[model samples]
Target: MTPATSNGWLLETRGLTKRFGGLVAVDGLPLAVRPGEVRGLIGPNGSGKTTTVNLLSGLYRADAGEIELRGERIDRLRPHEVSARGVARTFQTPKVFGNMTVLENVLLPALAALDRGGHRPRSEILEHARGLLEVVTLDRQRHALAKELSGGQSMLLQIARGLMVRPIHLFLMDEPFAGVHPTIKDIIMETILRMNRAEGVTFLIVSHEMATLRRLCERVSVMHEGKLIAEGSFEEIANHAVVLEAYLGR
Candidate 1:
C-alpha cells in the first residue's frame, strides 16, 4: 500500500485490524483525522476505542492494515520510533513515574527527545517543561513527588508530559476526562483547545463523556464490537439509530 498522500489526512488507517486468539479487538477499522482537528472517538464498553488508540500510538501492532501519519507508514514502527516521528499519546489511566517529581515527569521526555536528535539545549528544555506545567496548572506541584498527586492532578501531569515532546503532530488521548473533577475536566478541555488553536496540534480524544465531546470535537466517530458504526457531527451521531441502539441497546 502507498503512503497516505491523499485526502489531506494527518493520520489514517486502512483496513486496520487486530486480534487476540479468536477475539478480534479491532476489525478492519478505518480512521482519518486531519491536521489541527479535535476528533472524538467514543463508544460503549469494549467497543475498540482504546484498541484503536493503542494501534495508532504503536503500543500494539496491527495484524492487518496500514497506519500512516503525514503520508509516512508508522504501523511497523516501535513506540519510541512513533514518538520520534511526531506522534505522542496518553493512556486511559494516568501513566507517570510515581517516584519522580512532577517537574521531572515532564522533563524526562524533553531529555529523551534530545537524545533522539533534538537540537534544543538543556536550559531550553527545562523552560519548555516548566511552561507546560504552568499550562496544566501543575507548576505549584513541580517539586512534589508524582505519586502524591491526586487522580485528577496525575492526569494533568500526563498532559504536560505528552506536550513535552517537541513537534507533536498527533496526540492520541485515551479517556482524558474519565473520573476527573469537573474543574480538572475544564482545565483539560481548555488545554486541548489552547494546544489546537495556538499551536495547531491535532488530537484524537477517546472519551465516554458525550457532553464534553459535543463541546470539544469538531467531528466524531463511533465504534462498536471492533468496527466503526458511524461518523459525523455530534448532532448527527446523537440522532443516529445505530448509535442509539449501540449505546441504549435493543
Candidate 2:
C-alpha cells in the first residue's frame, strides 16, 4: 500500500522501502500524517520504527518509494535540504553543544536559518532564541554551559535548537521521554501539546511509552517486522488482537 495524502495531510509516503544489504529495514510502508495531529508510531524492537524515521528525515534514502510534503516531492532531497523545506527532527539521544552556553546552543539554528538566506535580522534571531529558552523554562540558565545541564535539560535544549529553523511545519521525534524524570516528562509533554495547539506544528513521535502515547496521540500506528499492522485510536489498538500478539511475541 502507498501512503496517500489529501488536502488535510502534511506528509505522505508511497511504497517507501529500504534495505541493508539483504535485510529489509522498511518494506513498502505507506503512511500519512495530518496537519496538527500528534501521530504515534509504536512497535516492538526491530519493528523498523527508527528506520522509518531516518527515511522521513532524509538521513537515509529509500531504495524504492516516494515521499511528499505539502504536495511536493521530497524523497530526492538531502538532510539539510529537507530541513530547508520546513521539516525538523530530534534523535533518540539528545544532541547539544557541550562547549556552548544554553542560549548559544539554541541560537545556532537561527544562524543557520539566516545563512540559508532568511532575511531576519540578528536581533530577531537572538530574541527568538531567548524566547525559546523561556518556553523550555531554561531562561535563567541561559548562560550556563550545555554540559552543566541535567539529562532532561539537555533534551529540552535539543528541542529548542530544532525550533530555531524558520517555518518548521513537521517534527519527527524519537524517544523524547526515554530517561527523563517524571516531572521533566510532564514538561516535555506539555511543551509538545502547546506547540501543536499554538504553533500548529505536526508531530510524528516514536516512543515505547504506551501511556504517554495514549495521552499525547489521537491516532497510533503499529509496526511489526518492518510493516505497519494496525492503526486506529489508542482505545481501539489497545484491544486489538493483532497488536496483542505482536507485543506478546505470539
Best by TM-score: 1
Evaluated at residue 161, the lDDT of candidate 2 is: 81
Candidate 2 lDDT over 1-250, as tens digits, reads 1122565568988899999999898999989888788999999999999999999989999999999898788999988888887788888888888999999888887687678787889998899888888888889999999999999999888888877766878888888899988988898898889888888888899999999988999999999888988999988998999999999966
| lDDT of each residue in 85-118, candidate 1, tens digit only | 7788999889999999999999887788678788
TM-score, each model?
0.96, 0.94
Error of 2 at 78 (Å): 1.3
What CA root-mean-square deviation does each model show from the true structure?
2.6, 3.0
Q: Which candidate leads in lDDT?
A: 1
Stretches > 4 Å off in candidate 1: 1-6
Q: Number of clashing residue pairs in every model?
A: 0, 0
